[model samples]
Target: KLVVAVQGTRKQHVDTVGPKVDRQKKSPVCSYNEWDPLDEVIVGRPDNACVPSLTPEVKAISSPQQWEFFRKFGGQFFPQEHLKKAVSQIEEMCNVLRHEGVTVRRPDIVDWSKAYETPDFKSKGMYAAMPRDILIVIGEEIIEAPMAWRSRFFEYRAYRSLMKEYFQAGAKWTTAPKPLMSDELYDQNYPVESVEHRYKLSSEGRYVTTEFEPCFDAADFMRCGKDIFAQQSQVTNLFGIEWMARHLGPDYKIHLLQFKDPNAMHIDGTFNVVGPGLVIVNPARPCLQSEMFKKAGWKLVEAPKPMVPDDHPLWMTSKWLSMNVLMLDEQRVMVCKHETPTIKMFESLGIKAIPVDIRFANSIGGGFHCWTTDVRRRGVLESYF
Candidate 1:
């Protein structure tokens, strides 16, 4: 048996909806530090074109064709100039971090032409999202999670190769079958099922099985780590939580938020989390159940609705990419351009926000969090002496 130390809430984050076979009303017990009310965003440095704040610590493989793919599929909305601005912003972030003491690591962009050479990388699409679990760095090694999609063969060999290069040891993947009926719920556009798939990946890969047909939807994405744990209790759900508790211990905390809902297209399409204690969520998408937000101690800043008419070309174009932001550190954030409200909010709070143009990357449905896995992150300080 794997002897991993895990902490945080045992309850699934989805439980706020209602109690069912998979979800329960169990009082969450957290050994980790409670989220503090985040009020101010402290800008550490000046906004210098030369000085760096947001940095590209890591990046996925890229190709010219990949860039075209983004333009055709995800970047359809923005003019060339807008797109350029986004790309430049990401570079600025990377420079800023390097300007500071932090080290920025970029993955050699993936070469899709010779993909088969890497046995572990199955062609999910031109943009293969970085697994969330594996990206989080723990000590010297990076933890990885991989999943399977219909007709897509599991690329165990490619995984092995990738892990060996970037990480100290090989990776451990998390995945499950496509549990939802349709990829979308109620004809909504954003990627709700994709978020649900994350839970499945974590549970099945960890050997948890509820045997209950899992459900998926857009709102499910925003469910925090605690909410997801609270809803899970069946063989698979419980097993998943227990494994994480044992393995992760008390250092890491999981949080999830949604940018769209039943009629929505993308959560990050217009919203994102740019830093700790701040989120750039679009009010048009619909508000999440307040309990989840309150418990996590996140402060929300509503973004303006999409400027493009609901049916315009730019309408909901960000769906192809995951629009939400990822926290590389306390000071820097990576965000999608459409999530401008979030970017501005972070800036107001003094947190530096770097907007990455993900039109090319979003076609397969991933944002900064889904695209890059943080192999190592600073551990939260232990509360007790």
Candidate 2:
């Protein structure tokens, strides 16, 4: 029961908050690891996708050269032609997933161009192009991350319809404590002067986000059955890691992995766990805790160099997204049609590669794995590490 005050006799006491969870039905949300046979997914939309303003948080992860794009087009839609190509590419990618016998669901198309003001801050919005950054599934639960970016604060609005349906179907839905993204949440002087300075700061575990409160993007974590690997990135802090560790309880082991990445935003592009005891690591962002994986008899393969050409506008992320392929099962993968070396690498490992072109989609941000958040994967919770 909820308590409400009757207002002026015009509005009666209304309880509009409670959502019922049927305990009898099995949850639609279920996934323990990345390699399980995918059953359902949530693909984000590029519609009304707006450029985030060049705030301090945005400044931390992006290169100085790319700052012009954000400055000129921030809080505005991306170039019309670019967004059109991206839409078509993603539609084809979704069809490919359906052909592979997986159910693909999409978030509601939101007008991210709308500007909003919070008590602590005022900002426009970013696109709902990357679902992997906001949603993560562990077993039967879906965790909504308390992300750091002020523009992305209301990003979860796009997924509420699906979240509600999943909840009614008995999935455990959890939204982390949203942080007050005031000036206190950022280190205004956090170094981004040059690549060398970034490298030094990252090595020392210094990031732009302060420990003022818990904040993280779901993409900062990589799920591998009982072992979940996470990184403290520019958008993810130590406080956020601690919050996840405590919230996940004893069923999961959150291993804080370190990498030598200057602009480490998401772990999937850097250290992706493809299968049981098999991980594809980015040679550019070497994992400092890789010796542990080696000691555990895990085969860590180096990803081939990305083939995304120079002058290709990658507004939000790095070219390492070529390595961010999604696993359909232990035997099949969704990869870039153009990345021949990546396809060859998978074929050599006996994993069949299903090629799809999303180069234009990659321009906005994200590849296969980054584009979709797996809702259900046929698997049970078991220890792997």
Candidate 3:
């Protein structure tokens, strides 16, 4: 007969064979904001990354000039030579993190070229190279996002091992309800020809993603202690933001921010909250709610123009990635080696810049903030706004 210990009327099971457990043990996942002292983080991999198909969602966010690249290379690996350089650059980044005394973990490398079919749609996988787009750490819990892209539906599989480890170590794990990427979930007639038209539509809250089901990319959200700033983008709908608000309960306040971007997708590149009261605002894509931050006594600094050459291929993003930096702590920032103006800006703010060259990696769609998710940061929950 198996011996089981039950507590009260709830019928909670106590492990009889294992050592005595401490119920008050702190969870291994505890990151309230972006600038906390870094402890452990999950860095993404560039292995076997595949280009997503040129679907409506992709078309909505991409510039008109980059469509040809997507049309030619969709459903295939990014140029092998480019990927090779990205891999080397990422390895150096991991090394830099290790040198900083931070524990770095990586996702399992899976073949993203494999195709799969669901009841709603069929598509191949994209890279597991951006952990920040799929996983969010809010206090002691790790929430897996239900990404909007069809190519990203199964991206969570690469992070399951890490999730299990964190859960075993006493972390609360939650996966938001996944959205079915059916025809109804997307606007089949979303205007993609003109940037001006897209800007008008985005301002009116008409995005490529419909409200058929809650869908969001984790990158669309910027966490700041008790308050979280979110955006309704081509990949993040109003319904998704509402779902997150309700799911997080009244303890956390979710602020919906709008910007002047025509191809808005991720907020990190546009309005990254680097500290409790400091934010790096993109000059090109100005936030409409700038006055709110100002009234709250927050300093919104405009980012200097990016130095990425016009010939460089940024397939899925713009040059504003220069602003998407990761904060190791309130005093240190991981920034692009080539972005000299950004480095100077960080220095002017009294933040040390740990420059790493990820120019090739940036081609895939992210920067330091997008490539890694801070798993355990030394901080507590507090209201900054």
Candidate 4:
């Protein structure tokens, strides 16, 4: 049985769709939906499914040493309010899975309390898998690349925890090692060419996809982006991306996005084939041409446009990062609210679109799709006449 569990903000829902609300104000939350259609066919493990042995178990001990350890590590990265809310939701999601007979587990502070209590707690935060705490369909292993300062501390850790947990659940996981950049460029810290996204295996897992070459410089990024100070490299870093891809699965296909004429923001930003012959891409900024999508037996749909020119009032208000989508099937997808128009347009073509609420994180640059990666997908079974 396929299941999907969602975390929603319903009170905000009414305000977003209210007739009097500003289109721009409501735009960010417009696609929010509690029940997504993709769940009917593709299970959302992070939201529901659980693995038993992979679950974290805690025991109470009278020893002061143990008590001290628990007190120290029990809550590190999050403030009380945030931690409470996060834990509650995680528990609820787990319970839902338990009700459905799925084995599930959550990471705990039992073994690493001492490591977490230090000032370097932030570095050790990798163990916790903060904001994106749970790992699902991808298996018991966690995977990640470098991120910004604030995000690096806890979010990366959360990503790792999920990856580790996924591997524990019997799924393969992998990633590209951090590249060694020149010191002169180190202060700028922008990658000229690299894999921006990756895929881990799940169920008959066979292939992996990543962003193409012709690396972007500051000019390719938003004008307001800090990395705008650098230059782009023509040579592609296909090997680094290929390294991670091959480590995780068998066969590989590089879905290279054409540069020069832009359309999609990044690889994950658009060009998701949720179902065979059903593709979601930004007609303006695409990984490849519409012909590619059509040739792959995919039906194309334009993705949401990103608002840029950082200084603009609406810049932050508009959705720019297209990386926030999860594929439920080749035809069905779970997308962020900002992608509502894209979803509606897709449904117009007889494609089923399911929206997931992720407004808070949308402000942070990524949405639900960016937060999670599907490790497993149902294989296309060709029927004989």
TM-score of each: 0.46, 0.95, 0.95, 0.46
Between prediction 3 and prediction 4, the one with superior lDDT is 3
lDDT of 4 by residue, 1-385 (tens): 3233322322332323223323343111111111122221112222211111100111110112333433443434323343344445445433543453334433333222223232322223222322221222222223343222211223333244545544444444544343322121111222212222111110111112122211121111111001110111121133433443454354223233343221122243434434434445655443434675466455566665653334422111134444345544435554544556666765776656555444433432244444433333323222110
- RMSD for each of the candidates: 14.8, 3.4, 3.5, 18.8
Write candidate 1's Cα lDDT for 112-202 as tens digits.
Answer: 2222222322222122223431222333333332221211122223344445443222223333333332222111221223435433443
Per-prediction tally of clashes: 72, 0, 0, 41
lDDT, candidate 2, 1-385, per-residue tens: 5555442354344556443455676789999999999999998899989999999899998989999999999999999899999999999999999999999999999999999999999999988889999999998999999999999999999999999889877888999999999999999998788899999999988999999999999999999888999999999999999999999999889999999999989999999999999999999888999999999999999999999898899998899989999999999999999999999999999999999999999988898999999999998988889
Stretches of candidate 3 above 4 Å error?
Answer: 1-22
Give per-residue lDDT, candidate 2, residue 64: 95
lDDT of each: 0.35, 0.92, 0.92, 0.32
lDDT of model number 4: 0.32
Of the two candidates 1 and 4, the one with more favorable lDDT, higher being better, is 1
Q: Residue 150: error of model 2 in Å?
A: 0.9
Off by over 4 Å in 2: 1-22
Candidate 3 at 135: error in angstroms? 0.4
Question: Could you tell me how far off, in angstroms, the CA of residue 77 lies in candidate 3 after the best superposition?
Answer: 0.8
